[model samples]
Target: MKNHLKSIVLLVLTSVVIFSCSSDSDSSKSANQFTIEGQSYTLIPDNALLELKMDNHIMDQGQTYDRSSITLSGLNGTTIGTASFDLFYKDGLPVEGTYTITGSLSDNDPDFFDQLLVDNKLCLGWTSSCAVSEAGAPTFLVNANNPTGTVTVINNGNSNYTIQFNGNYRKYDGNFEVIGTSPVVINVTTDVTIQVF
Candidate 1:
């Protein structure tokens, strides 16, 4: 009888251990869940690349709409800037190509200086140094001097699209002259589904 009771207790303990291990594994797997049919998807860069939080996308009657705003942030959660795009759609879907979006420096803060940084290196200086030829539609190029890269959008099935930003853009609080050494390279890929009503 003593031996039987010892065996039963051991079996119960083993079952508890197995249940706990499986529960932990399931939770880890569900952390990266992505629903293609869902309206919104979060993009977390694998290697401390740019952190983009996309939300508040509203579609218009003509299918042409404006993304409420795209929040661009640094790996350490610094607000780089907020960009808005005017998307052109045909037959109820956005055209697949490189679409230019108007992005302002420093979230359009009046107190912030107009400068662009790539990999934490000073790319574009103050408004006086790096003047925009067309104030209405300002476009920046990323190279050795400018240092920032470009963003490309690819179309996936079911209203899903992959947004690839191939550069590390940084933001500074003060003037552009205070930029320090060039930080590490950052490339991020994000998948999102746009809702067209």
Candidate 2:
């Protein structure tokens, strides 16, 4: 009877261990329901390149969006303006992030990578290459000087994003504002979808 009881105890312990392990293993699935159709991504460059609405370029960028850098933006306190973003595959999951740009110095003419790094290197300069600020916000070129502040990633689809550069600034074009504030912060929301075959 003791042996039988001992066997029963061992069985119970094994089952408990298995249940414990299974519970822990199941937690991995508790994450958000992130799905990728296959391996395709939609990308929008924050630069004038996207402004032109060139079909060919957009197609090309999407083909290799994961490897390339593209513009990305989000609303500040308020939320308006659209910042283009690139979505790609990482570790079997679709990931998206912003591209850091240094605009060219001269408005008259620009060289390759025309935008020079800001003195602080936080923001890109004003130029053809540097993506323009939201349609109307007050924005000029990098002014041939590095931006003082750095831009940060407010949020990420995957990990809890930490702040990064401070440049991709908000040029007020007199768009939207807070209820009471004169020229409140711009609120932005952009959603990019990726379809993989």
Ten contiguous residues minimizing lDDT sum, candidate 1: 123-132
The TM-scores, one per candidate, come to 0.30, 0.23
User: Which candidate's lDDT is highest?
Assistant: 1
C-alpha lDDT of residue 103 in model 2: 39
lDDT of 2 at 184: 14
Model 1 scores what on Cα lDDT?
Answer: 0.31
Which segments of candidate 1 are over 4 A away from where they belong? Answer: 1-95, 99-147, 178-197
Candidate 1 C-alpha lDDT tens digits along 1-197: 99999999999999999998888774343332221111112234442122222243333332322221122222112211222222322233334445332233422332221221111111121110111122233553211112243444555665344444333333343454434322222122344433333
lDDT of 2 at 31: 22
Query: Every model's Cα RMSD, please?
Result: 14.2, 15.0
